[model samples]
Target: MPDNGDLRGVESTPRRDAQVRVFAMPPSDNATPTQIVQGFLEALTSDDPQYKTARMYLTPRAAENWQPERSTTVLADGPDAAARAPVQDDDEHVAFTLTGREVATVDAQQAFSPSSGEYNKLLRLIRDAETRQWRIDIVPQGVVMGQSDFERNYMSVNKFYFASNTAGATRNEPPMAVADPVYVRSHVDPTTQMVRSLLAGPTTWLDPVVRSSFPTGTALAKGAGSLTPDDRGRLVVPLNGKAAEVGTGRCEEMAAQLLFTVRSPTPAVEEVELRSGDKELCSLAQESAEAVATRGSLHSPEYLYFLDEDQRAVRIAAGSDDTEPEPVPGALGEGEKQLRSVAVAWDEHTAAGVAVDGKSLYVGSLVSGGSLGEPVLRSTGKTEADRLTAPSWDARGGLWVADRNPAAPRLLLLEEGAGEPMEVRTPGLDGRIQSVRVAADGVRIALVVEKGDRRSLLIGRIERSRPDGGTAERSPVTVLELRSAAPELEQVTAMSWTGDSRLVVVGREKGGVEQMRYVEVDGSTPDIQQPAALTGVKAVTASPDDKVPLVAYSVDGIVRLPSASQWQKITKGTAPVYPG
Candidate 1:
């Protein structure tokens, strides 16, 4: 794909969203004003790394002023610039107005935030006397393309960081790696770009809840051009002197952060080596990197649990279909209490259950001979409809639930699933919460708030503050800055944090059929990629390991949908759930 001289096609990263790769060609000789504008827009959508071809249609002054890396504004449809109005008195000047409907924007830090509005801008073109060719005299600062082009040109990747507030986090208990998702150019050097983004720190929205191990002023070495894996599958990164000052433990953490951030694109990389000048700071292998961040380090659940026909909690093998359902070895599973809904802990050693009346919340061990404890938290609502919703457990041994009492609605949290229930302050919440799902990272919590007749899904960041210089265990908690995660769904019936930054939601539009789809926490992009439709879906749950089958309680009773397979009714059960 190159001509005979020194010129050649640029190196490329694999395309994650599409199979075809599109290239942009330079402007033709003596192109018309409209053609110049159109050609430039086409170049913006191609795989040109730094947009060199796109700038060829711009004037020398405009080219230097344009900053394509500043941001990318995605529209519902590609911009229209065919209509041109010629300028009077200046025979060589003409202007075109670009118009489209804005959908979302990716900032310089690669954070995608959803937006909506009319997009309109004017571009003026002038014919150069020397070359007698038309070129754009004024250009927009950033790239603008349709949603389709945005997907084609970019891919999403999660940058790993440690949770800042979960103090007692361990490898298997509380998830340590917080996934800060960002968009990167699909055809660029994405691995190297991801490393730079990791060093730059988390995005504005996620910075308050997560922290990077890399110290301040730390950056890549002066000129480590185009990092790639060697034949032995080791990719070495050279960092600046600022990063070289960290100790051994922090250096390994930096390596783990780099390893996970680039794993999506460079899965073949067996090891990552960090260097400062010629000295090796530290080396970490992919096999043992989980010691630093434990998210996705463990296997999927071995059994799926639910309530059986007799209203007793039961369990079945997660990998087999012929296995008969049996009552679990816990108090909740012992037919001692009738449960209306349930939640299991991350380790599968404990579980929380809501009574049939939904006012009492109980915790019990799943081991044989273990007993059920008294109600950890209870609601005093008059009726079952106004009682507590299902309970949720955080990664750090914390249990969360919301009481929908019309008089004193509250979101309660228990440390280690015991002791006095602490009321978590919700600053921006204006409606009564009906559901609760805390992310494994423990930095985010999802709530279904009900106002009048509408139920909306909102994601809020959890902030832990020490007012009087208290210990790690005494950090006061608050859930503020709540943002809508599914603004289009008229009613979000149920949802779960299926992945790091993604949620599987069951919702409906205005007088439309109920649908199941996936939504990101930002609530900016539409959920075009979704799951198959299931009817009478009462609740849906997915494992933290995200690789397991989806289990839901619906009209078909308890059903499981394996990867690339149709949903099958495995047993006649209700309130099915995999351990959180």
Candidate 2:
């Protein structure tokens, strides 16, 4: 364990086990107040003081009913004498007078430095006066200490009770009255001090609740029913409809319920079987299954356009829609290919979709191939490359395609009515383009490039007046450094922009944990905030207003976070889908 530093010791003296009796009387009119006060003074000066003169006798008791060992450093002359001689006059005594008589006498143990000793003497006087014998025998039941103001008001009370009998008292003498019990829950990610959720029970049950003291980024789940750790050590919460999936990490037991929406199944039905990596997971219902795309429009609602069992091209619109559904378009003609991935322009005016037919990208000894003769966006005839690796839409309604066959990947810019696309070169971007996003203003473009497993983010400015009609000027903004000794983050799964222009990156860490991070474009250190543990995260899209992010996890259903505080379940019945 790392050394944090030495522990601090308590300033007061330790507790002791010896029991001592002291006495005092209730003041009355007939008996002069001075007479009552004189009684207390005489008790302290008696042949033997009933209470111990050591400072340890004045320290508060511990909760476990155990007294701390008495300190050996008690003042030689005692706290009273050492505390006041320097400030006291020859004829003046350091004492308290009740009415006109000195009921309690105090002495400074150390004359030169009296503050510490004076405090100790004052404490003893108060203790002795409170526990003194009453005209009625009120036993010295307990000793209570408090702030100076609290002590003043408390001492004015006409009655006293045994502190140990209080419902919440942890010790014989409680400083204050018992208070109502309250439950506090907080979720924090240690890596990034981002507070995923904090809630006080009963009022904020729907908010994510994380345990205090647990490592940051720890996943938590709370609901109406009880949560128990499963055989696999994962925390499981069973809902009314089905079992809800929770992120994995340290689990804390708490009392709170997260609100979730439960929905009835739709009427549409079409069963189509599919295979992923040779494993049969579930049968897809072409007609019945609905695809809802977030941040998408009617023209291009499908961020992920897939062919249903009926060979239909279905587009799922983004956002919440209550409109009546319509039949999806049948698969494109034999000459037209299926789109594997698509990218839309920042202005949403243009888009480029890519499909591969009968070709494969080599990765070690693994041979991966897509459908052959797939209809992909026409590429610029800059090089005689046969296939397009990834395609994106530029700001000016133009399409850019990356030809990956050649060692040097070429960028082709295609215009609306161009017969042959124009090839454009960007300085300082030597790696293969993996993903791209157009800036908010449509004049700047951000690209994610990869060299082997290492990735780097590069930004480029579009120049229309260049000699070649269009030019891309590489900017100095380098968003992410994928190559680090800490841990290698795998494939870039999703990217979105917050309202403030900070880029959010979602990917898998070396341990296969789905992680989310943010990097400000204005040049600041990256803040990587870990979300709940997830197996396979297929799609991550932000709301148009950037207030919420809807993440679709494979086999875990859809999780919706309206804000950091509101985690809602938006889907029911259907299991999460995993892509090949």
Candidate 3:
């Protein structure tokens, strides 16, 4: 810790875009009104504790009323704090127009959402009667900055939630962990802020589908703010009395949520101890958290599956030696089904295969002597190109695929990879369906829609309507709120879900070379370094487990990129995949 109290608690992480540290400078001895505004804006972008330097430039009344923690407005470039004409009514007053193109906003709850619009805010500066110097008398609530500044100051972290498991007591199956990502200050007690965000409940978009284990009105114990792990990497969280009421099982669930939500905090946390009003409730180690819920969560140290040159399903041990790929034990692997692409279920017991002609979708088990059943789905498109896209499976036994018949494009969902197929409504979709991939959480789906020469990558939210006594004929499921995830790319060739809120995309910019990168589901580009560019990436697949290597199907055959390693040829196979 530093001698300066303000710098003591803050970590010394360099800015994302810069090599050197960038700290907020306090108002100068005799700063002008414009200087005060500019300095204040810059300070808002800094990781200063509660924007203390920014408050110094504001009038006492303004500073007292200002709330920088309420929300954050991010712009394309930055606010243009240009000096406007002076106020004619008062000689001591001057007005400035702070203008910028709004790109997105982070609400008080820390949920980041994409937005677009013209921004116009008025800031009034008044000459202080005592100091005879300019001070901002009026300002907007919350902070505002450029996107780049936001990226440098804030990082995205996921808050865990359990699926709306209404079947409470059966114990037949545990609810899965749902990841809800939000942005928080990079170094300003992120562990504490993440806990607060979790206590505040989920973001609006995810609120309906996910459930928090915390009791209603549950909050941190009074005055238990700014939590940090001790030298032993143990974090003790003191919660309100509401948390103490739960039993051992539920308390462990609450601790699991905390362990995951606070894992991003630096100086890593190994264990989390939950306490309520001076009494320790429960303690959970970080590794043990996943077992309580995410057992079938596409776990790591799993094999990578793909179709070889013979159009047979094969797999190689992920993150392992560069050995030759072997055939998977299944009818699709042994039988002469002649498949184009395939999707292995999360449990790895069943699989879905798209035929070589791309007109049929077949399903079967993955054990020895597992026989392929009749085609579960058969597209009627005249040509193979207009048939079914690659099959994708969700954690909740939902299989998704898009039919690009052109005449009647449809997004279909098969329940448990069996029975009658349900047509998933595409409400805000544009053009014909090109490809579809459902996320592991099953709350979001990624699609590549081709309207013309341009192929766009869009992210759609899954909404299961299921009205009372609804039948398969009714519009029970729909993919809504279609928004571009990669508007900068001209043509999207392929993509795969890399994690809870991130995707690995293979695409080319307008007239640019083909490249591979990652983009957040909120349509924001993360600050982490992207994978090295690969050429002719026809398809891509990534694991929910970060330790598993990223595999891709390219013109040069199948290749895998391990963490911090150069691309290595795994084998000559196409449509490489991990348990989805």
Candidate 4:
């Protein structure tokens, strides 16, 4: 139906401003005040360094005082509602109010944390007498951007810190390093930004539980710019000469920290070489660093365990050789005691469970003919919803449980034997904890809390306090510093700590479907991988090792992902569990 096969007018008309490139356009001599403000906002989305060109929209005096690095405020879409037409009072004066919801904030130190509430930024514009163009005169101290622009402009990288490797660490376990997540500019070399954030210190949330082996005040040697590796895949990091004061053991530890942190974003780096000025101080190969710096390395379990239709614990062989489900020889596995949830120890030597009746927690050995111990913990909840949650065991052999009894909710830690369970206080907790999963480091606990009918995921740091009196004083007591870790997620149903600082959680955004995704403990961003394909998931479990596939319970049966080519059904199971 086109004349002369032209077909020029077949489509509908495009938007008037569709071809306009706001970021590329500078203020014309006759540009209005609002146009200048819009241009400035668009320029912020560019990858330009120091925002030199963007500064051209501002008066020289305002440009000299405005500091974008002081803070960053993230806003939602439809920034038009936040923008206003400038009201001019005089030839040189105009003002407008820019409003938005502050989703997150990046401080001057580059630490990213969740922040909420409506922010109203006052914009004062002035007409330059010389150029006869509108320029930003007085603005908020920080930069404001919409969510889409924020995601495209900023990225996240994790800095590594080590557990204390000093004299008191348990001999059975190799030294381990934990990850601290931070946000930085996506255009800049993340390797250098990550290293700089590493030197600055851990975010306040993780500062208590993690420690950096790099000595205090340690920094990149003066004159060094970005981090880059040599032809041999060796990343050479130049530290200020102050590092020379530490001994060889300390140097290796510091190298391990750098090796893990740098290799995270730059997988091409095979080894890390630490230097003071021009002198090489130490070097650590990836293999050697893995022994000391890695956490949650993959080690397949002897069997993939879950609860069968009979509410009994059962096991199926893990790895290539898939086997039919079989009940273990222990009492808990025999179905005499009904169970609602279960947890297994890393050694596969012990198992813990919550009774179906919702009042008792039992711990027993997994070995054949092993007797089920007496109920080590009992819940005081009066309702089914208030009953005991799933129990978890830390690497140190301590069992943890949350009794969501509305009358007396508490998080209790039970020792291996029949020792009295100590109540772990979660300070700053404003709601009842529905579930708790302790990290392998034994210093962080992932909790699902219910506040005002909404469930939120939280990370709490476990701190120990010793008696001040004598060497033979009372046993140390553990306390929790609880904080909201995932403000972006509105309703979190179930969660599992998969790595040092990553959690795979089943949650839904406002008015969205319930789905599973990997989120950092700091809640700065989601994992790069798209949320895994899963449906009808009632509960999910994953091994501490990230390489292993995740296990989940759906209406069909128990299923393992990517491990069996598809969601292979294991059996009619309820709760699938793995060692922490």
Candidate whose TM-score is highest: 1
lDDT of 1: 0.85
Q: What would the per-residue lDDT of candidate 4 be over residues 288-388, giving only the tens digit for each residue? A: 87555556543456777788888999887654346478986587798768999888887788888889888988888877777776788887777888989
Per model, state how many residue pairs clash: 1, 35, 0, 0
The 10-residue segment of model 4 with minimum total lDDT is 15-24
The C-alpha RMSD of each candidate to the native structure, in angstroms, is 6.3, 27.1, 5.8, 6.8
Candidate 4 Cα deviation (angstroms), residue 270:
1.1
Q: RMSD (Cα, Å) of candidate 2?
A: 27.1
- lDDT computed for candidate 3: 0.84
lDDT of 4 at 264: 71
- Cα lDDT of all candidates, in order? 0.85, 0.31, 0.84, 0.76
* After superposition, candidate 3 runs with Cα above 4 Å error: 1-23, 86-90, 115-118, 165-171, 295-298, 465-467, 470-475
Query: What's the lDDT for residue 345 in model 1?
Result: 84
Candidate order by lDDT, highest to lowest?
A: 1, 3, 4, 2
Q: Candidate 4 regions off by >4 Å?
A: 1-31, 81-90, 129-133, 164-168, 297-302, 319-323, 328-331, 334-336, 416-418, 468-481, 486-490, 509-512, 525-527, 563-566
**lDDT score of model 4?**
0.76
Stretches of model 1 off by over 4 angstroms after superposition: 1-19, 82-90, 129-132, 169-175, 296-299, 468-473, 524-529
For residues 101-143, could you state the per-residue lDDT of candidate 3 as single tens digits? 9999999888787788888898988888888878898899999
Query: How would you encode candidate 1's per-residue C-alpha lDDT over 2-92 as one tens digit per residue?
Result: 4577865879988766567788989999677778999999999998888999999999999999999999999999998955755444468
The stretch of ten residues in a row with the least summed lDDT in candidate 1 is: 166-175
Q: Locate the minimum summed-lDDT window of 10 residues in model 3.
A: 165-174
